[model samples]
Target: MVHEGVLVESRTMRASVAEHTEALDRAKTLSLLPDGMHVTTRMVADYFEVGIEAIRSLVKDHRAELSENGYRVLTGAEVESFKDLTSLDKYTGRHLALFTRRTVLNVAMLLRDSIVARHVRTNLLDTEQWARTASTTAPVDNSVIHNLVAWLDARIRETVAHQLGQHDARMTRIAEDSVRTVIGQTVVPLLNHAIRADDERRREISDIRREVAAIDRALRARMPVGGMAAMDAMSWREFEEHVAGLCRRDGCVSVANTSRTSDLSADLVGRTADGRTLVVQCKHFAPYRKVESGEMQKFIGMAKVEYTADIALFVTTATFTPAAVDLAVRHGVTAVHRGLLERWSAGRALQVLR
Candidate 1:
C-alpha cells in the first residue's frame, strides 16, 4: 500500500503512473482546447479547483518535471501561429504557457494541497496497479498514448516551422537547428527509450529527458541564457522588486525597493547578514546600452555618502562602460554588469557582501 503522501512526494511513483491521466477525469471534467490535445494554465487550475496562483506555484517549483510531460511556453510568432491553429485570448501576453493531458497528470502527482489533485493521484495509483496485472496476460490498448504523441508531434513541427519563419537563405540554418532541437533532441530519443524499456527501466529515462529539455530550452528559447536572462523581461519597477528578492535570498533583512528621485538614488535598501546597510541601483537596460560614467558617479556617491551604505551595488542587465567601471572601482562599489549579474542571480554568493 502507498503511504498517504507518497504520490505527492515521490517522483518515481509519479512517472510510473503519469500515463494514467484518465485519473484526472475521475476527479473532475477537464476542459481542453478545441482539438482536445492541449489545455491552458487557467483550464488546469480550474479543473484542479485551486486558485490560479496555486497552479503557477507548482509549475514554478517543478517546471522540469512538468516540462518533460509537455508543458511549454510559446513566444512571439509561435503565439500567433498557435492562435491561428487554435484560439488564444489577448491576455495571454507575448508568451503563452500550454499543457498536455500528461502535463496535468504530472501536476496531480506533485501538488500537495488541492483536493482534486489528491483524488487524481489516488485514482492514478489504483489504475497503475490494475494495468500491470492486466498487461501480464491480455493485450493492453496503447491507442490513447499513441494518438496523443502522433498529434502532438505534427503540431510541434507545424508550429516550429511557422514560428521560425523558415524562409530566405539567412534563416535556413536557424530554422533547421531549432526544429531539429525540439523534435530531434527532445521527443525522438525519449520515445525510442520508452518503446524499448519495460516500466521499471523507464525510471532511468527521467534524468536524461531533463538534460535533453535543458539543451532544447536553450536552443528554442527567445529568453537569454543564464541567471539574468529573466531580467530582460522585467519592467524597471519589477527589476527593483527582483533585486529585493535577490537581496533577501542572500540573507538581507528588511529588504525593500526604495526607488526614489532624490540625490540618493538607491532603488533598493536593506541590511546584510551582519546588519550593515546595503543599497543597490538597478539599470534595466538593453544589452547594447551601458551604465555610463555619469550614472555610476551619481550612484556611487549617493550610496556611500548620502545613504552611508556599507555594501553599495550597481547591478545592470547591461554591462558597465570602461569609465563607469573605473569610477565604481575607485568608489568601492561593486559593479555588477551582465556577466557578474548572471553569476549572482544564478546563486553564487555576492563575494563582496560576505
Candidate 2:
C-alpha cells in the first residue's frame, strides 16, 4: 500500500519523482536567498531544520546524484562572479555551495530522521494520489449515450484483437528495423566523425603540453639555487604555508596547516604514506638566531605528549644550539635545522624521519 514517491530511502525512486518539488512548499516554506532562484547551504540546512555541517556531509555522500539535480560548489573566481550576480556581499568564504529547488527536493527525498523531510514525503505521496484519482476516474452519465459508448468500446477492442493478434511478430520486426535504420542514418556517422576529430585534437594538445613542460623546466633551471634566500625573506605566515606544502609534496595525506589553532601554533599535521601520524611545528626564525634547549623541551611536550604523533618534527630556519640538539636526540625528536631545511627545499626527502 506504500507509494513509490513515499519511499524516501531509495535514491533512484526519489530522483524519478523529483518533479514533485512543489511538495516541499506544501509541507513547509522554503526560504531562498536574495537571488530567489538558488539557495545557499545554510538556507537549505535551515529549511530541513538541520545543522549546516549535516547538509555538507549529505552533499559529500550523495555528490553525483545531487549534482545531476543542480547542486554546485563555487570557489575562487567563481565565488566572486556569483557574489556579483547575487549581490550577496555578506559571504566572504573561499567556497560557496548553492542548491536549486530540485536539488533541495532531492535532498529531502534522500534525507531521513527529519520531521520536515517526512512531511515532504507525505505531501509528495498526496500529490501522486491526487493526480491518479483526478485523471483516471471520470464520472459517467446513466443514459443512452453511455450504452452506445460502451458498445463502441467493445466493438473496437474485439476488432483490434482479431486484426492484430496474428501480426505481433511482424510488428516487432518492423519496430526493430526502424530503430536500426534511424541509428545507421544518424547516430553512427555522427559518432564516427566526433571520434576522429577528438583524436586529432588530442594529439595536437599533447604536443603543446610537452612544449609547455620543456619551458617550465628551462625556467626552473634559471631560478636561484635551493631558494633558501626566498625562505629567509618570507613572512612568518608565508613560511608556515610553505612548510605545509612541502609535507604535502612528500606523499602525506590530509596535510593541514593548523597555524591558527590554539593547541599547536603553526603545526603541520598529516599521516605519512606508511600510515604513521606526522606532526611538524615550524619555527620561522632568523638563521643567526639559535633554538635553545628550553624551546625544544616545550615542543616535545606539545607535539609528542599532547598530539601523540608517531613522527614529531621541529623544523626551523635557524640551527639548534648544542644543548637543544642533545635534548632533541635524547627525546627522539627529528630537529630539522637550517641545513636540513635547505636540503629539503632543494628537493631532498626527510628520510631520517621516515
Candidate 3:
C-alpha cells in the first residue's frame, strides 16, 4: 500500500510541473510589461492588455496584500518629489497611488478572474528562474561568452534609445494639445468679450448723436426771426445773456455769461458737443457801425492764449470792416455779422465769416 501511494504522488507532482511549464510557454508569447519593469496601475493594465477598470477591480479585491508588499499612496510633498524624479509633469498632483514590481506581482498572484494576470504571473516566474540559472551557469568558452555579452549590451542600448525617442515625441504632442486647449478656453472668451463691449459702446454713441439732433431741431423751431434786432434794444448785460442763450441753443454746452467782468475778453464761455472750448464776444452795435480790426485782434489774442479756446466767435448786431474781416480770417477767428446773428438768433445754423 505504501509503494502504490508513492507512485501516485510522483505522478501528481509531474502533472503539476507540466502544467506550470505550459503556462510559462504561453506567458512568453504575451507582452506582460513595458520596456521598464516599473509600473503604475494603468501601466500594468496596458501590459496585460486589459481594461483599466479590470485592474482596478483586482486591486480592490486584494488591496491588503498589495499594500503590504509595495503598493503606496504618495501624499503631500512626496507627490511633487515623485514627479520631479520621473520628469513627468502629468504626474504632478497630490494623493497619487503608485505600484512597485512586488505590488504588481502580488496582485497578479491573487487575481483569479483575469487570464492576463495569470499570464503575467507565469512570465514573472519564468524571468526569476532565468535570472537564477544565468547567475549559476559557468561559461565554457571565454570568446563565445564575450561575444554574447557584447551582443546583449548593444541590444539593450538600442532598446533604451528607441524608448527615449518615442517618449520625447509623445511629450511634445501632449504639450501642443494642452496649449490649444488653453487658448480655446481663455483667449477665445476674452476676444468675444472685447467685441461685445465695443459694440455696446458704439450703440450708446449712436443713441447720443440721435438725441442731440432732436434737441437741435426743437431749438431751431422755437427761435424768433427778428431776435438779433430785438436784442439791440436791450442793455449790455441783457445782450450778453441773449448771446449766451443763442450759444446754448446752438449746441454749446455749459454756456455762461461773463460780460459783467471787464477783466474777461469774452462775453460768454462754453463747451461744444465735441469737447472744444468756445469763446464768444458780443458787440451790440448800431446797424451802420463797423467792427474795427484792433478790437478783433485783441479778442483773438485773448481767446488763443488766456482761455485756450478751440473756437473763437465775435458776434455783432452790425457788420465788420474789410480790415477787421481780413484780420479775423488770418487769426482763425469767426466774425459773425448782422445777417449771421439774425439767422443764429432765429435758431438757424450759425454761418461764421471764415
Candidate 4:
C-alpha cells in the first residue's frame, strides 16, 4: 500500500487526496518503481540526478513526516538483506535510511533547489491531464487502466529525464560564460577603484612630506651661522627682553621677563590663549655649544613642582645635546633649539623642537 501521508488518519488522507490529486500524480511521475514496487533513498537521488547528500539533508529536516511515510533505518539483517537484494557486495554499512517511492515523491514536492524536481513536477501535471482524458474514454477494466496509466507515467518520466540532461549541459556552458562576464563587469571595476585609491593616497603622502621638508629647511636657514657674535652683541638683559617679546608675539599673554638671580627656574612667565601658564628658561649660549642634561634636570623639577606650569619651554640660541633632548622629552619639555629661536624672532610660527 502507498505510505504517503500515512501519519495522518485514513479519513483525513482521503479528504486531502481528493482535494489535491496533483500530489498523487507528482508522486507517480517521480517514482522510480511501478505502483506495487519499493524504492530506496539512493535510487531516488540517482533518478532525480541530484546528490545523495541532498536527499539525506531533506530526510534529516523532515524526519518525523518522512519516517511515517515509508522512510526506514535498516539495521542488522535488514541491511544485509537489502545488500543481497540489490547485489551490492560493497554495501557493508548498517543503520542506513531507506526511502520508498512515496517518500521520494514527498521529497521531490518539498525540494526547492533541484531543477530536476521542478521538471518532475511539471511532467506530473502533464501526465495527470493525459491520464484523466484516457480514463474517461478508455475501457472499464481496472487492470487495463492501470497498465495504461503506468505506460504514460513511464513515458513522461523518460521525457523529463532527457530534458534535464540537456538542461545540465546547457547550464555548464552558461556557467563558463558567466565567469568571463563577471570578470569584465564586476572584478575589473573593483580593481580599478583600488588602484585609483592607492594612487590618491600616495599623492597625499608625497604632498605632506614635501611641505614638512620645506618647513625644516626654512627653520635651519634662519639659525645663526656666526655663533654668539650676533647674540653677544646684545646685553644679557636685552636677551631676556628678546625672549619675552618673542613669546608675547606668538600668542603668549601677560608676558614678564624676571631676569633677577632670585628667579629660580623661570626666566620668563606668561599665559597662553588657552589659559595654561607657560614657564620658559632662556640660554643665550654660543652656536657651537649645547645645553647639558644637568641643566634640563633642574628645569624639569622646577616646572613640575615649583612653577606648576602646563607647558615648560627651554629656549636657547644654541642646540641641545642628545642627552639633554632625551631628558627634556622624558619630562614632556619642549626643547626650542637655535633654528626655532631664529624662526620665532623672524615672526614665523614657533615649531617647537621636542
Candidate 5:
C-alpha cells in the first residue's frame, strides 16, 4: 500500500490550497461592494456558497483588508439586526400591504423632490467661494469630525426611536425606507452644497427645514395612537434629546435648548471632561438649510460673555457659511454639520471609541 504518512501529507496540502483559493475569492467579492454595505454572515454564505464554518477561515485570512474596506465582521446585535431586517416585508403580513405601499411611495416621491432641489444647490458649490476657502486636502480634524459623527448618530437614533414609538410597524417601516432613498440620492450633493455655500447658504437652511418638516409629517401622519401634531412634538423632543447628548459627549457639559424663547446665544452648555465649560448653539434645520455667518458670530459673542464657557460649538443638521467657520476659528469656536457627524458616529471612525 502507498505510505500512509505520505497520503496524509497530500490531503493536508490539498486542504490548504483549497482554503487559500476560497479566501482569495471572498476578498475579490468584498472589493466590489461599497464601503458601507453591512452584509451579514448568512448573506455571505448565500453569496459565496460557503458553509458558516468556512466563513471563519476565509474571514481570518482576508479580514485585515476586507474588514477595513466595509466588509465588517459583525456579531452580537449587529448581526441579529441585519438578519432581522433582511426581509422587512415579512413584518407586514398582519397589516394592509396596499396602504403601506402607498404611504411609502408618497414619502419616497416627496423625499425625491427634496433630493432634486438639494442636488441643484449642491452643484453650485464647485463655483462657490466658501468651499474653496475651507477645503482641506489633508485628513480632517479628528476631534471635530468625531463630534459631528456622534451628533448625526444621535439624530438618527432619536428619529428612529420617535417613529417607532408613535407609529405602527407598517407606517414606520415605510417612512424609514423612504428616508433611506432620500439620503442615498441627496446627501452626497448636499455635502457639496454645504461645502460651497457662502453667506447666502442660510437660505438653503430654510429649505432644509421644510424638507425635515415634510419627512416628519409623512411619518407622523401614520402614528397609530396620537394626532399628527402630537407625533411631531414627540419627534422634536427626541431630536433635541439626541442633540443634547451629542453636545455632552463632545466636551460640552451642560447643554440646554430654547427654541421656545429663540435666545440664540447658547441653547446648550456644558464643560469638557477637563473642567473647561463649553457652550453650544444648535440649529436643527430642514434637509436643505445652511447656517449663516451671522449665527456663527453670535455664538462667538455668547461664548465671550453670557455662557462664560471655555469653548463655543455650533452644531447643526445643515451646512455652514465659510465665514462662519472662519469666525468660529478666530473665536475658538467649532462649527459642525450633519454629514461629518454621521460619518464620525456611524462610520469606521467610531470603532476607535469602542
Candidate 6:
C-alpha cells in the first residue's frame, strides 16, 4: 500500500523511541542497584523519572527483564530477544522487508549519523552523506539519505504527538545510542537482504511468465471439445456473475456488467482496496481458436475509455498468442487463458464455464 507524508505513522515511532529510552534507563538502573536488590516497575519508573505506565510498557514492549522474585531473570536467547525488540513495529518491519541487506545496513549507519546530528551542531547532510559513503564505499544517492531524514523527522513529530516532554540530555543520549544500536544492527542488515530478495522475486516472476506462455501454447493447440456445447448455451451474464463470485471469495472486489451492453463488453471489473482496478474482458470463444494480443489490446483501449481502469484483464475460453502476451505486459494488461477462466467459474451462476 502507498503511504502519504512520512512513511511511518506517529504512534509506532514514539513506541520505538520510548521503548529504546526505557530499555537504556533500565540497564543503567540495574547496573547501579545492589546485586540481589529487587527492581519493581515503580522503582524503574522512579529511577528513569518517567511515569510508572512508561516503565511498565518498556518492560513488556522491549521484552526486557521484569525481575520476578527480586533476583531470577531471563537470559541467553531471552536477552538477545530484548535487544532485538526496539523497533519491532509494522512500519519498521515493512521497511526491513523492502530494503536490500546492504541497503538496510547502510540505513542503520545513516540512522546513527542522524541521531548524532540531533545532539550536535554537525551538518545533517554531511553526516548522512558520510554514513552512506562509509556504508556503501561508493557514490550513493542523496535521496536515500533524505528518506532516512524523513524517517527521523516523522519520529520527532511522533514524540510531539505523544505529549512527551523535552528530553533531558541524559535521556537524549540514551535514546540516541539505543536507537542507533537497534536500527543499525538488526533492522538495517535484515532489510539489505530483503532488497536483494525482492529483486530476485521479480526476476522469478518473469521466468514463471515465460513458462506459463509455453504451457498456454500447448493447451491452445488442443481445445477440449466435450465442454463446447455446454459453454455455448450459457449466457454471458450468468458467466460474469459466476466469475465475480469466485473473485470475491478470493478476497477480491468486483463490479459486473454495470452497463449491460452486448456480450463483447467488459463482463467484470475487479478492484483491490489499494486502488488497483482491473477491467476484465471475458470472451467465450470456440475451443480451438486462440485469442490474439491484438484483441486483448483492443479491449484494453476500450477499457481505458469506458472504465478508466489502471489494469486490463482478458479472460477467455481460449489461449492468447505470444504476441498478445507480450502486448499484455507492455500495455499493463493481464491475459488469463481458458483454463484459468474455467477455474473462475465454479457453479450456480454458470457451471458451464467450469
Query: Candidate 3 — worst ten consecutive residues by lDDT sum?
Result: 28-37
CA RMSD per model (angstroms) = 25.6, 23.5, 41.2, 38.2, 31.2, 29.4
Best-first order by TM-score: 2, 1, 3, 4, 5, 6
Instruction: Report how far off residue 87 is in candidate 3 (Å).
Output: 80
In the range 236-312, model 5's lDDT, one tens digit per residue, is 55656665765555445555566556665667665666677766676667534777888887778778887676766
Cα lDDT tens digits for candidate 3, 148-242: 54665565456555655756766655655565566558765765665566566566556756775795577445544455436667777787888
Model 4 agreement with the true structure over 1-354: per-residue lDDT tens digits: 233223122434333333232443332233322112345677678767788898888888878776666778889997776554333455667765676655665566556666666644444444444455445433234455457546655654565556557667666556545555655586557656655665665665567567757955774456454323345556667777877877777788998876585558788888886788888999888655888999999999998898898888888877777688778777888877765565456566654311
lDDT of 1 by residue, 54-111 (tens): 9999999999999999999999998876764443444457888999989998988888
Report lDDT per candidate.
Answer: 0.75, 0.74, 0.63, 0.63, 0.46, 0.46
Off by over 4 Å in 4: 1-229, 351-354
- CA shift of 190, model 4, Å: 96
User: 244-341, model 6: which lDDT tens digit per residue?
Assistant: 66556655565556537654457777785455675677777665578876787778777888778876767666566767766765666656565445
**Which stretches of model 2 miss by more than 4 angstroms?**
1-6, 141-354
lDDT of 1 at 245: 83
- Identify the superior model by lDDT, candidate 1 or candidate 2: 1
Error of 5 at 13 (Å): 51
Q: Model 4 reaches what TM-score against the true structure?
A: 0.35
lDDT of 2 by residue, 1-354 (tens): 355345666766676678888788666657555344578999898999999888889889999999999999899999987675444678999999999889998888877767888888877776666566446544333354456546655654565556567778677556546655665677567656655665665665567567757955774456555465568878888888888878877888888878776665337888898888888889989866888998898888887877888888888887777687777777878878776687677787887445
On a 0 to 100 scale, what is the lDDT of residue 310 in model 6? Answer: 72
Q: Give me the runs in candidate 5 sitting further than 4 Å from their true place.
A: 1-236, 249-264, 347-354
Better of 4 and 5 by TM-score: 4
Higher-scoring candidate on lDDT, 1 or 5 = 1
Best by TM-score: 2
